[model samples]
Structures are given as C-alpha cells and as structure tokens.
Target: MNKIELLELLHQEVVPALGCTEPVAVALSTATAAELVGGAIEKIEIIVNPSIYKNGMAVGIPGFKHVGLNYAAALGALLSNPKDKLQLFNKITDEISKKTIELIEKKLVIVTIDRSKEVLYIEAIIKTTEGTARCIIKNSHDNIFLIEKNGVLLSEQKELTILDNQLYKRLSDLKIEEIVRIIDSCTEEELLFMYDGVLMNTALADFGLSEQNKDGLGIAHSLKKLTKNDVLGDTLFSRIMVKVASASESRMSGCPYSAMSSAGSGNHGLTTIIPVVEFAKYMESEKIKLLRALAIAHTLNVYIKQFSGKLSATCGCGVAAATSASSAMVYLMNGSTNQMGKTIINMIANLTGMICDGGKIGCALKLATASNAAVMSAYLAYSDIVIPSSNGICASTPEDTVKNLGRVSKLGMQTTDKVILDIMLEKVMNNN
Candidate 1:
C-alpha cells in the first residue's frame, strides 16, 4: 500500500468498539443472523473457530455477570445493532438482562464447533419463530459475510479473508524506518482527524468514572483523589494516569461506553493513546503537537499490530502501546529520528511478550505498568541509552529487534497460548 492507502488501512483496522472485540463480534454475528430470521430467536447456535474461542474465553460483557461465548451470543441476540458495527452489543441494557436470563434458563444457546473450516471463523445460526438464518465473520472480528435466511440467501461473497491473510506478509516486510516516516510526516489535516478517537475514548473513560461499577478498578477515583490533593506537582500525572488507567479498567470490566478501538480491540486503542495524551498534557504542550503525537501513537500501534495479527498468544497492547509512547515521548522532547528509533528498540526489549488472558480489571494493572515502562524507555532513549544487539531478542538495529519480538509472539508463543487457553477452559468447565 502507498502512504495514503496505508494510513487509511490503519484507520479502518483501528476503529471504535464497545467491550471486548471477541464477544462483541459474537453479538454482531448473532444480531446479523437474527435480523435475517426476523423474529424472536427460539434457539441460538454459535460455532467458533479455535482462535475465536481462545480470544473469547476470558472477556467480560458489561451488565452480564459472565464471560464466554454463550452469554455473548445471548446478549447479541437480545440487544445488538447490525448497523452499529463495532458497537455491536451496545444495545445491551438492564431491561434486557431479565429476558436474557430467561433465555439462558431455557437452554436456548448452543455453542458448537465449525468442523469443516480453518481455525479462524465464526458461524452463528439463529432459529427464530419464523425460520432459521445464519451469519459468519471471517479473518478479523466484525468482518461479516454470508448472511442467510430460511432457504433464501440474504447476502453472499466473503471479500476480505483472502486479502487479509496477505496483510501479515505485507506487515512483516515493512521497515521500522518506513513506519516512522509515515507517522512523523503525516499532514496536520490527517493527524487532526484522529480527534474522533480521542473524543470517543475520553467519553468512555468519563462514563466509567461516573458509573462507579463495583467490578471496576476505580481508576477515576484514584485520579480524583490525586487532583484533590493540595499539591500541583502530582496533579497532572494523577489526572492523566487516572484518565488512561480508568478507561482500561472500565473497558476490561465491560463498560458500556464505546472504545475507539485499534486492531479489533478497544483496550488496544486506550492503551496506546492515553499514555501519550497524559504525557503531552503534563508538559503543557501545544494542541497541534499533542494531536500529531496522538496520531503517531495510535497509528504506530496499528502498524505493529499488523505484524502481530489481530489476536495473538502475546499481548499486543504491551508492545503496541509501549512503542507508541516511545515515539510520542521522542516527539515531545524534540528528539531526532535516531532517538525515536532507539526508543522503539528500548520499548520492544523491555515490554515484549506480556500475556493477554482476557479483558478485565487486571488488564488495567498491566496497562499501568506498561505505561510506566513506556515513559522509562522513552526517557532512556532520549538520554542515549538503548539495549545492544548482543542482548537476548535484541538485534543490530531497532527494526530487527521488533521483527524478532514479532517472531516470538506469533511463532514462539504458540504452546504458551495453548496452555493458557487450556487452563482457562478447565476453570470454566470445572466451575459447576
């Protein structure tokens, strides 16, 4: 892709989402299928590819006291908006919870396997009072294809899967310098457009603070206390940390506010943007400079995630957000391109391979630590400190180190992912 096309691609891949992308995808598929059926769905069947199951196992759905494909399916069928896309399950409300519980009690949801396909597909079948319909999302979450109703096919053609597979190859081929050039030189018009991301993500953080949901980690409260302190030195850090961390805490706990998501996940967007925003505001930086830095942070995350794939055994947020923060910190310090490059290397060496269990309050804790690491790595790079090529997973250059980290995440961590998934499944299956 050319620079303009690549920027647009990154924009589309990293969009808005509510709750965990996995379960929202389930709800989206279910909602689309139910729309085809055209009535109250009597029975809902979900068939997921192995990768989907792995990503969905531990995520939360706001208002639902459970985390799994079944509840997601139920919530989707009960309250989802087909046109809303990323906010697929945003319609879920307290009024619908009672009806959803009744449906669960009736054994109306059946989650099964898609035996005749690859390890990355989801087929949701809705049998309603009128007839049966189906919807399938392939490649990445919310990439819906082939919606069918009764004996009539409502939609056909799966357009992106074949093309999306090529994305991993293309990303692996990109040079880190090229990615940096794209971010560093994007025009003001293009950079300012991402204010949409800031607006939506900030709104969600505010909502999480207001709701004070017990399950949430109270990042907002922490910020409030810090702001209330009579001291000015700590107030800025407190506000930014609280804003960024609280958003993660709320989203992980299934907050209803839509997240300006990246790489099919909202937490990814929050993780990447909040730290940069917090730091920029702390320095009383110019508004335009802050926007440019935010753009750099968000787009760099998308760039890295392109190589990492949408879902991985390793935590994309850890490296993605950290790299973004590194670049933004460099920009804020008026550091040179070399400084930014070194910051990226420092970040990759320090925070690579954090595991993603699922979206929850604990994720906030991880994000906080990652944000701290990002600040440290960027400061170190600005001060001319970077890991050498001889270090473990380090290479002769920054780009080489990143590629090495990608290998570890996509190839080296396969067994670790399986072990984590197996343990999670065991806990869920054995709970009753």
Candidate 2:
C-alpha cells in the first residue's frame, strides 16, 4: 500500500467505539431494525454467529450492569441512534434503563444461533407496536446488511459479502524491513499526533475508577499499588495501563461513554496504549518518541489483525496489544530494527494461542497475560535469547517469524476458533 492508502487504513482501524464491540454490534443491529418500524418496540429476536455470541456473553454493555446479548438488545431498542454506526446504543439514561429493565422483565429479548457463513453475523428483529423491523450485520462487527419493516424491505442491501484478500493479507505480504523503515522514518509531527490516544485512554481509566462505574477490573488501583510499592512504579505508562484496563473492565461490564478503540475494541486500545505509555514513562521518553513508539505499536497491531481479520477466533489482544507492546519495548530500549524483530518473534511465540472466549472480566486475564508477555519478550529480546528459525513455526529470522505468526493466526487456528465458538454456543443453548 502507498502512503495515502496506509494513512486511510490507519484512520479506519483506529476509530473510536463505545462499550465492547460485540454488544455494541448487537445494539447497532437491533437499533437499526427498531428504527425501521418507527414505533415502540415490543420484542427483539437476535441471531448471532458463534464468535459474536461468544464475545457478547463476556463483555458488558454501558449502563446495563449486565453482560449478555439480552440487555444489549434492550438498550438498542431503548437508546440506539441508528446514525451512530457502532455507537448506536450510546443514549442510555436512567429513564431508558428503567424502561429497558421493564422490557427485559417481559422476557422480550431472544438470541439464537445461526450456523452458516462467517463467524461475525448478527441479525436482529424488533417487533414493535407498528409492526416488525429486522436488521442484519455480517462479516465485520458493524457492517449492517439488511433492514426491513413489516415484511417490506426498507434498505436495498440484504447481505454483506466479505471482501476477499483483506488489508491484513496485503500487509503480511510486505517485508518487515519495509515496515520498519516506514515507522522509523516518520516525521515527529505524525508520531506525536497519536498523543490523543493517551488523553482519550486516560479519560476512560478515570471514569472506570470513579465510584459510579467500578464493576470492571481495578486497573487504576493496581497501578497505584504497583507504583507505591516499587519506586519505579510511579511511571506514567504503568499508571496509564492500570487506568485504561480499569476503565475497560467498567465499560465491558456496561459503563456508559465511549472509548478510543483500535480495530474495534476499547480493550485492544488499552492494550496498545497502556503498555506503550508505561514503557515511555519508565524511559522518561519524549512526546515524539512516545508517539513513534505508539504509532509503531498501533500500526503493528493493525497490520497483524489485517491477517487475523477484525473478529478472530483467537483473542486479538494477544496479537494486537502484545505485538504493539513488543515494538514499544524495542523503541524504549533504543533497540535496533533487529531487536524489534526479535521482540515480535518472542511475543508471537508466547501468546499466539490465547483464545478469545468473549469480552468480560476474564478478558482482563488475557490482557494481563499478553501485557506481561510483551514485557518479558522485550526484556528477552534485549538479552538476545531470540527464537531461532529452526524451531517449530519460527522463521529463520525475526521478520519471518511475524509472517509465520500471521499464518498461524489467520490459517492455522481457523478450526480452533470455530470449534470453541460452537462449544460455547452449545453450552449456552443447553443451559437455556
């Protein structure tokens, strides 16, 4: 891709999002369907691809104090703004919550399994006083497909076809040396532009720490303890991750407000930001340096996910955040391009298999695992215990390892992703 193309890709990949992507996607689909009828909705019937179901099960919606597809569906009907894309359900208020609860009490939400096509489909039907509205999202989380009311088509599109040879596949085909050159040579202005990430992500941490929204992991508290106990703990970056993760926990558990999301997840954003920011603080790095590091980390994540796709069978945090952290660690250590390669290899070797069950408290465990691996891999790379190409799935060099990693993420784990989703869906259905 050329410079302009890369920039466009970056803009698309780094857009902001509210709540967890899964539930929000649910809300978007439902709200769009509800909007079609132009009246009070009475019932919602939702069918999801397995991965969507898995993610919806774990992550919480903002203001719902719950973590499943039901509340998300209700919130979509009560508060969704169809124009807001993935943020359609951002209008939740006290009155709305009460109304949503009343609807839920009526047992109005229904979620079903659809075992066809891609792993990221959500179809929502809203039955209202006027009639029924239906909306469908396919492939990507927020790509709305069909919308209908009273058996009449309200939108021209009925299905969203998955684009073959997506961006990640294209990026994976490039040489790592070319990518490193682009990252290293960027102007300070471009690099520092991403400082907005720090500001935005910090806001989330603060919100999560507030007494009103304290359901998720206490990342802020953890950071404070880490800082207080260890003299090195007072670094700005550590504080950032703690804050970011704490807020993510809150948001994932249903806190209101949006987060600056990378590739459709606030947690992914936190994973990218907190680790990079912490490393910067530890090094007392300059703003330009931090930006470059963050840029590299974020871009690396975007690049990896290009192959892994948006919603993957594996946890994207392990791939995106871990890769970003590894790159940031290299930048912090002032390690050369080769060291960067080593760090990436180490990260892939360590975290390529972390399953993404969904977005919930348990995701924090995956985040922590990936973040710790990033730090360790960075430290290891600096120490020169890099994995050789002779090993299983490892390339002869570090860059080759990245390609191998992408292959594993995109191709090798395909069935694993499906099987896991099927099992989870089966359990949900059996229990229901």
Candidate 3:
C-alpha cells in the first residue's frame, strides 16, 4: 500500500471514541441533526439497523449512568456538538442529563429498526420549532453520507465509489513481509503519529488501574489480586493481560474517557495495542521497533476486519484484534513473516468462534483471555509449533485463512447472530 493510502486509512478508522462505537455513532448523528435544526430539539427519532440497535441498546454512553441508545441520542441533542465525533458526551452537563432523561421519559426520544439492509447504519432526525433535521450514517460507524434540513437536501449523496473499495482492499492485499518492510522504512512523521496509539491507549489502561476500586467493578484490582502467575504464569504475562483487561474493563463499564479505537472499535484497539505496548515496555525495546510493531498490528487488524465486516456474530477482539497482536508479538521477538503468519494462523484457529455477546463490562474477561492466548500462540509459532492447514478451518496461507475465518463469521454464523439478538431483545421485552 502507498504511504498516502495507509495514512488516510489510519485517519479514517483509528480515532478516539468515548464509549462503544454503536451508541457513540448514534450520539454523533443525533447531535449533528440537532445542531442542523438550529433550535431547541423537541423530539429525537433514531432509526438503526438491527445490529446497531442490538449493540447500542445496552452499552453505556460516557459520563452517564444510563446504558442504552436512547440516552445517547437524547444527550446528543442536548449537547449539540457533532464535531466531537465519538467523544460526543464530553460536553454533557447535569442539566443536559436531566433534560435528556425528561425527553426519554416523555417518549420524545425514539429508537426503531431501520428495516433497511444496512448492517452498520444510524439515522437521526430531530424535530424543533423551526423544522426537522436529519443525518444518516451507513457502512462505517462515522461515515455520515446524508444530511437534510426542513425537508431539503443539504449535501449531495455520492454513491460509494471504486476508490473506496480499493482503500478497503489496500491493506488486505499486502503480504505480511511487505507490511513489515514498509513499517521498517516508515517515515519519522508516520512513526510519531503511530506512537500516539500507545500513549492514548496506555492512558486508558493507566486510569483504569488507578480507579479500579473506586467506580468500576475493579477488573484491574481483581486481576492484580489473582496471585500473579497462577492464572497466566509469571509477572510479564500478568502485566500484559491485566493492563489490556483493565482498559477494557474501564471502557466497557463507562469510565467517561475516550479510547483511540482501531477498525472502529475502542475495545478492539485496546485489545490489539495494550498487550503489544506493554510487552515492548517490559522488554525495553527500541522506539522504532515498538512503532513498527504497532503499525503491523493495526494493519493486520484492519485487513482481517475487511473480511469479517464491521460487526459480526464472531468477536473481532478474539479473532482479528488478537490475531494482529499475536503477529506483532512475533515481530517484536525478531521472528519472520512466516513466523508471524504461523502466529496468525495459530491464534485464529483457536479464537475463530468466540461470540460477541455485547459491549459491556464482561468483555474485559474475553479481551484478557484473548491477549493471554495471543502470547501463547506467538510463542508456539516462534518455536515452529503450528496448527497445520489440514487442521479444522486452518488454510495454507494467512490471507486465505483469514478469509475462511471471515466466512465463518459473516456467512456461517448468520443464525447465531440472529438468535443472539432475539434472545437479547426478548429479555428486554420480558423485563418490561
């Protein structure tokens, strides 16, 4: 991939998010529509795909106790800031929260299934004294394609172009060796920009650990108390898993801090980077080495997700995110592209079927387990002990293998995703 393409991809996918991307995207669209109306919003109507509704219905919006898309939509209108992107709640006030709750209680804020075929879609329409304003995001979490005010179009809706699809394939088409070579020769400007992932993600991990006992369920504290080395063996491994887990724990449980999410997921970003960053620090690796490793990790993550689609029945954290980290681990250990491929194969072979239940605190456990498994998978690959392609769901090459894994997630697991959503919604309706 060209440097320009890679940098643009990073700019598009890797950005800060305050909470789960689904709910956060809803908040962004809602806030944008509210601002477009240019007056007090009387009603907020949010229409989303089933997948978006499923994912956003339970995850917490940052800075609020409420854990649903309704709160996010209302707060978006109350705050009136769309430029914040996923960090839409950073400007929320107590008065806004009360007003948002009032709007929700009065049924002025509404959420419904879009009925359209979009998997990642959010349409927010806000009604004010002046008129109604609308914003629509589709295909990507933050790609707002349509905007309107007072029943008039505000922007031309361009069709998704061939160049866009090429952008998606640019990373997917890169060989592991080619990726490593590019990272090895990357410019200082790129390296410095990439280092921000480490700093941004590490900040969340650090804050999570610091506030473990105070607000959250103390995922970091629990991991620390687990008599290190008993669960995963040794201090180094514990450090990596604990840091990744704690950051996830903090984010999942609503820590009110934004994370530098990769592939449009904050948890995925934390899962992919925290372990590698912690490992580089633990080993005191050179700055250049660490930056390259991070680049490779992100590249692999984005490539794998290309096939898996954005949200799937299979957990991207376990499959794509962990696979990326495992491969990066091989790189950090001075292993070859072949060894990194083996690591990817080994990790995907084991983690392919893990379910994505939702975005909640329990996700911390899943991410930590994946992080721990990535280390083990990398070690085994580095030692040339790999699962053969003949094994179940394992292919001869890394690219083919990732595509196969993608098939399992995208095509094979259709029923699984549907049932999971049904059960989740059923429980909610039954409770009501």
Best by TM-score: 3
What's the TM for model 1? 0.88
Q: Rank the candidates by TM-score, best first.
A: 3, 1, 2
Worst 10 residues of 3 by lDDT: 156-165
lDDT by residue (tens digit), candidate 2, 37-142: 7778778898987677778886777656666888888888777577887766667778988887888889988888776645478889888888888898876667
Q: Each candidate's lDDT (Cα)?
A: 0.74, 0.73, 0.84
Which segments of model 3 are wrong by more than 4 Å?
161-164, 211-213, 228-234
User: Where does candidate 1 have its weakest 10-residue lDDT segment?
Assistant: 231-240
List, residue by residue over 70-183, the lDDT tens digit for candidate 3: 888988888889898888778888899899889888999888876455468788989998799999988788888899999999984677722267887677788878877877
All candidates: TM-score: 0.88, 0.87, 0.96
Clashes of 2: 11
How many backbone clashes does every candidate have? 0, 11, 0
Please list the Cα RMSD from the true structure of every candidate, rounded to 1 decimal place.
3.2, 3.3, 1.7
- Say which prediction, candidate 1 or candidate 3, comes out ahead on TM-score: 3
Pull out the clashing pairs in model 1.
Answer: none
TM-score for candidate 2, please give it. Answer: 0.87
Candidate 1: which stretches are off by over 4 Å?
63-66, 93-95, 113-120, 151-172, 207-213, 218-240
